[model samples]
Each structure stands twice: as structure tokens, then as C-alpha cells.
Target: MKNYSILSVTCLIFASLLLVLGCKDDTSGQQNAAGQQLAMSLPVVEIPTKTLTAYVTYPASIEGVVNSEVRAKVAGYITDVLVDEGQKVNRGETLFKLETQSLNQDAAAAAANVNAAEVEVEKLKPLVDKNIISEVQLETAKAQLQQAKSSYNSIVANIDYANIKSPVDGYVGDVRLRKGTLVSPTNQTPLTMVSDISQVYAYFSMNEKDYLNFIQNAEGATISQKIEKMPKVNLLLPNDSLFEEQGTIETINSQVDPNTGSISFRAKFDNPSRLLTNGNSGKIQVPKTFEDAVVVPKESTFERQGTTYVYKLDRENMATAASIVITQEIDNLYVVASGLKKGDRIVAKGVSQLRGATEIQPQEIPFDSIAQPIQKVFR
Candidate 1:
């Protein structure tokens, strides 16, 4: 019995030592992975140097070059409606006709007075030639004849003014007057409107800061030269579609609005199809191109306290947090102004799991593959 007890104690001691050694081996294996093994394995790409274009969009108000209010020259009831709304009209085309019965009656009375004055002048001219009457008497009769003739001519002019005509070549707007509607030159309401929409002007404003930057960057010494060298601007319609025709900068307001601190700009566009009209609203996209710009993918960056940061790989393939300054922005990418240069390598993806100075197993890949995934971009 004593020998059996000794044997059990020996077996128990051996079992305890084996258990302790197994636990030590497990702890050592876990230690090997800490700082010794990479925290994450992610694809990395080198920065690309290429030309890129960034667009700045501004809201704009559109109007035709000519928008004229059609009004009546004389006071009278409309006798005839000649032109339809939205109809194309030429200069001096009759749009409406005013009642001329009263004007015609006045013209007849004036004509009779002119005839009577002519008779008096004829009778006096014979007497003057014979010196039967003083020369002054004939001269007085001639002056009276001239006055009557003037009255007659004035009446005829008023008759012609009864016909309302279009002042320019354009499309007519809402016709407010119909047959029997009384109108006059000084009436509060206009007969209609005419808009020459063969071309349109887009009006927009820029803040003083933006205005200064634009003028300084333009390639010219004088304002006129700068305007001429300005690139064409694109129009984005309300539907978020690009207008087929591009526009050119026409003029800039010499003075800025003191209250708004903004300067006005106008751009002209050809509207051959007459699709654009007065009161249309749209956006103008001004393009700015950068040459040999260093660009980085937005997917590889994260913002900290309003500052953007990216994880760049060091010589030892460890992660290093870098601060980059962005000058312009394009789709899913940023045009780097500073902090990084061409051929610098950065972690492309899986950056949320990493921290600064951590070791990483880098899987080198093409920049496009990381920035623009084929599934997202192509599809």
C-alpha cells in the first residue's frame, strides 16, 4: 500500500509540470505576433502625376438679349387682334389695331379748314401781284394757310399711330389685350412682351475673393486681354444635364455690389433652337485645368478635426500618417497642392484598422485598381 501511494504522488507531480510548460508555450506564441507580426495587410499604390480638371459651379439667371414691352402709342379700344401669342414676328409687324372712327372724323374736319385757307391764299396772291392790297395783307393770309396745313398733317399722324407694331424681331409673349380692350401708351399694363431668344445671357455673381483669384490667374496683362483668353464655360440645366452649347464670357460689371460684396458676370450662349428663354435658371460650370498635378484617391484618406490625413508607407513598410494640402477636387480624388510628391507610396485601402507607425504587410497594386474599383466605376 505504501509503494502504490508513492507512485500516485510521482505521477501527479509530473502532470503539473507538463501543464505549466504547455501554458508557457502558448503565451510565447501570442507574444511573437505582437509588434513582430504585421497589424494589417492592405493594398498600397504610388501617387500619380497627371493633368486634371476641376469644375466650379455657380447658380445663374438667364435672360434674352432683347426683352421689350409692347405698348400702344394712342388711347383707343382694340378693334382687331392681329398676332397670336408665341408667334414669330418681324420688326414693325402689326400686332393690334385700335379703333380709328373718331380719328377719321377729326381728320375730315381738318381737311375742310385747309381747303378754305387755300382759297383765301389764292385770292390774296392775285391782289398782291396787282398791288391792290398791301403786301403785308397777303403775307398774313399766307401765315394763316400754313397754320391750317399743320393742323391737317397732325391729324393724319395720329391716324397712323392707331396700328400697334412689334418694335423688334422676336417671339411674342402673353397677349393681355383683346378686341374691345382699351389701351394707351401710359397704361399701367402692357399689351404683351417680345423676346428675341436667338441667344441668351446668363447672369451670375462671384464673391470678391473669388473675383480677385480669377483675374490674377488669367493669362493676360489687361482686363480685355484676360476676357478674350478666358475659356468657355459650360451650362448645367435645371435637370442636371449639360447644355449642348457652351457659352463665352461677355462682360463683367465694373463695380461690385457694396451690400453683397459680389461682382456680376454675364455669359452669352447661342440658342439656335430657341430652347432657352427669359427667366430660365441654370448653373454655370467654370473649368480649371491643372498640369502635372499630384493626385491621391479619396478612399485612402480620413479626416481628423477638419484636417485630412492619409497613411503613407515608410521604408520599412510601416504606416505613417501624412497631412496633405488639397488645391482642387475631382470625382473621388484630390489634387494635392503640397505635403506629398510624385512616386510616394501610400496604403490604398483598409486604413480604418491601422494607426501611425504600425507595421503592415503591403500588397502592391495599381493605383487605378485601388482608387477606381472596376465594379464601381464601370458599372
Candidate 2:
């Protein structure tokens, strides 16, 4: 009986040990499976070589081809605003009318003086002819009549100046002086402005270095020839939309601005629709072409300490962060200058979630699917 009890206790102890070991083995297997599933599945693509055109943008200001300020010829209170803002007017059309009541009164008084002088000269003419008065007296009356006529003409001219007229055929700008506002030629502010919008000018600037590069790269010996050879440029509107009409490089300032250390350039665009007006602001985009350039999607790039990097993949699908130097950025692509080559495999997305030497299951994708469509690229 004692041997049977000891054998049963030994069997129970051995069974308990086996159960604990089995549970530990199962837990270990589950941990290993979970770690295997943690490796992320990311998309990748091979770099491409293509001819791409990039744009270098600079701030631009829009103005009408002809901008003329409308000023009052004589000082007077404004009585009539003949034109409204943005109203189209022809040359010599009335723009504003100043109060002319005082001028009219002066004109009437001068006319009466002329009539009196003429009557006195006529009365003296007969007396001089009859020898009733000396010839000197008649000559004196004639001189007074001439002076009165001159004064009358002067007053009449002033009354005509009270009606201000448009100097050019254009659309009117802001009316600075309203009804009852006094204005004159010497006043700093103009009554209004008129601009011809049949065509427009887009003025932009380039630094000294860029100017030098542009002239040297152009295919011409003279500045005028270079401008003719330059490609047509595009304007980006204030809302970030591209202007429908393209512009040509019309003029390059002969001298650089001493204060800004930059040179100004003027581009002209046909404004048949009158969409552009004076004081409008936009950006000028100059196209630059790169032949057989190695390009990458900007999405795959990451910056670290001022250095740009990309996750380049090897045959084993292991990603290594490699530094790259970018030459230019076009829309959604980067033109690489160095540190990367054509046909190199790179991670397409999720670069921030990756680390160096990380192994990934690379799902190959088309470059176009990863990169945004380029805008206004020629070829």
C-alpha cells in the first residue's frame, strides 16, 4: 500500500511539469508569428530618365500697356463725375466737370469791359476825324480796348478748362476725388487714372547671377536677339491658376537697379479679353529644359539636417537611406544632380516610417502612379 501511494504522487508531479512546458512553447510560437507580421508592405519603383522642363518662378506685377493719370487743369470743386470706375472711355471724352459758376461770372464782367472800351474807341474815332480831340486820345482808347479783349479771352479759356477730359482711350481707374472734392494740377493725388487694356505688360526681376546665366545661355550676340530667341513664359495668377495667354520677353533693362541689385524684365501679353488690369500681381514662370535628366518623385524624398535623402533598395529588397543633391524642382518631381542614378530602385512612399537597412516586401509600381502629373511641360 505504501509503494502504490508514492507511485501516484510521482505521476501527478510529472504531469504538472509537462503541462507548464507545453504552455510556454505555445506562447513562444505566437510571439514569433506576431513579429513576422510587423514588417510593413510598402510600394517601390525604379527611377526613370526622361526629358523634362522645369520652371523658375519670380514675382511679377501686371500693368496696362498705357497708363495715364487724369488730373484737373484748373482748381475747382468737383460738380460732376462723368465716368465711373472701370468705365471705358474714348480720348477727349469728358471725365469730370468742375464748378464753373465763378469762372462764368468773371467771363461776363470781362465781356462788359470789352464792350465799354469798344464803344469809347468808336466815340473817339469820330471826334479825332473831326479834329475835336487829339489823335493821342483815340490811340489811348484803342489800346484799352485791346487789353479788355485779351482779359475776356483769358476768362473764356479758364471756363473751358473746367471740363476735364480723358487724354487716352482706356478704362477708368479709381476716382480719387468725388463730387464736391476740390482738385488741381498741383495736387499730389490724381482725379483718376486711365489704362489701355488691349494689351498688358508683366514686369518681373532677376538677380545678377541669374541674369548673367540667362544671357550667356541664350542663342544670340545682342540683347535684342536674345530676347527674340527666348521661349514664351507663363503667368501664374494670384489665385495660383495659370493665365490662359502666354507672354514674350519684350525688354530687358539696360542698367541694373542700384538699390535692389537686380535687373528688371518686361514681358508683353495680348489682353484681348481685358482680363488683366493695372496693379494686378502674379508670378512669372520661365521654362528651362533638361535633356535626359534623371528624375524622382518628390514624395520619396526626406530631409535630414539640410541634407535630402531617399530610400534606395538593393536586390535583397533592403532599403538604405542615400543622400541626393537636387538641381531643380518641377511640379511634383525633382531633377537629381548627384548621389542617384537612372534605373535605381527606390521606395515610393512611407519614407518617414522606415529606417536604414530595413527589409521590405517591395510591391513594384509605375512611376506615373506615384508621381503627380507635370503641368505645362513641353515634351
Clashes of 1: 0
Query: Clashing residue pairs in candidate 1, if any?
Result: none
Question: What local lDDT does model 1 show for residue 277?
Answer: 90
Tens-place lDDT per residue, model 1, 1-379, is 9999999999999999999999999999988868476457889999989887778898999998999998888899999999898899999998899998998999999999889989998998888899899999988988988998898898888888898889999999898779999888899889999999999999999999999999999989998999999999999999989988999998999998999999999999999988899889999998899999999999999889988888998898988999999988788888898879999999899879886687888999998875562355542
Query: What is candidate 1's CA lDDT for residue 368?
Result: 84
List the pairs of residues colliding in candidate 2. Answer: none
Q: After superposing candidate 2, which stretches have Cα over 4 Å from the reference?
A: 1-13, 23-44, 109-150, 300-305, 309-323, 343-365, 374-379
Per TM-score, the best of the predicted structures is: 1
**lDDT string, candidate 2, 232-305, tens digits:** 99999999899999999999999999999999999999989988999999999998999999899999999999
